[model samples]
Target: MADRATMERIWEAHTAGEFVAQDVEATMDDDPIVVHVPTAMGGSGYDGVKDFYARWFIGRNPDDFTVRSISRTVGDDSLVDEMIVSFTHDIEVPWVLPGLAPTGQQVRIPVIAVVDFRGPRVRSERIYWDQTAVLARRRSC
Candidate 1:
């Protein structure tokens, strides 16, 4: 089991845009699973699963981002959350979908993340969100 404080810190850090998430291991059958869904990035795992926010999502100063609200459901060693993510895309980067160029723009999308813990570290995780929503809002340079 993980301490509530530690879990809270992890959530806070994630919301704060400090993207050095340690041991954010994820799996298909994991408690906190980002069920297979098609988005701008395609399907599961880190690279193609959840869209990056810090330096990868927008490709600019990540400090401009914020996580509005986080609702958590705690378990023995697992935590699941629904997050409201808000951010401004101000740079150019690769798209999770193949062969798509960067479209610098600002976007906000709601997402859900499930995380399992091994002590104070995450053992596995899964995240779900809408990539189409993000892509639809992109602005051409």
Candidate 2:
């Protein structure tokens, strides 16, 4: 089971736009590692995860986003979290939808994540969220 402290740190770090490679690594398995993401933003693995951010956040100003609240359910080696993520698309980012111009919009979306941990690391994760809302907002701008 992942401790609350660790989870808190994860939330804080994510919100700070500081992508801790170790944190990402702690949430995956050894074989065919995968991170199942919600709609709008599909899933990926280790390098893929990093790549996703590179294309998504890194493409823009990392300061535009923040990760919050990582509520977790502990079950032996599994840790499930419903995290609250808040961000503003004030800067130009890569892969972001066109016409979905950045209105400097700030949004808070709840995402559910299920992760299997190997010791202090994560083995695999599946994240779910409301993609339509995200798209609607992006499009509205």
Candidate 3:
């Protein structure tokens, strides 16, 4: 039962950072799909998505995590946001780098999130980032 304000809240609150299951169930469509394309992370449908968030995304960021918006494009049914996400590699980020130990390095990665809506509730979302850029800093020249 989302309205315009809830939609706005979903955009501002969820994508700008992250959220918990209650926040998700209230703002997301009954059958929502979310994909982190670069690493093939994320999940399909409500339950799957909730599980994905619980296991990987939610509460996973380091204490120094931050996100800065670069730009955004809004449409009637969708929005695309460009952001610079920064954090200390003090936690194992399975969504971004699977099976890799934290190197204790500072990470700043550009992220693009494309989100679609069914009426006012979120229908789907796809996140993209450069895996090479994330890995390159650790490589020895």
Report the number of the highest-TM-score candidate. 3
Ranking by lDDT: 3, 2, 1
Residues 5-34 of candidate 3: C-alpha lDDT, one tens digit per residue = 555567776654473232566667899999
Off by over 4 Å in 3: 1-8, 16-22
Which number leads on lDDT?
3
For each predicted model, how many residue pairs clash, with residues at least 3 apart or on different chains? Answer: 3, 6, 0
lDDT of each: 0.51, 0.55, 0.80
Writing each residue's lDDT as its tens digit, candidate 1 over 1-141 gives 568778667655543433334223322222222332333332344543344432234333344555655688887777888878665554333333334443445657787777766666545556677777666666332
What is candidate 2's lDDT per residue for 35-85, written digit by digit as tens? 335434433556666665555644354364555656667665665777786
Stretches off by above 4 angstroms in model 1 are: 14-17, 20-63, 93-104, 139-141
Q: Model 3, 128: alpha-carbon shift in Å?
A: 0.5
- Model 3 poorest ten-residue lDDT run: 15-24
Candidate 3 clashes: the total is 0
* Evaluation by TM-score, superior candidate among 2 and 3: 3
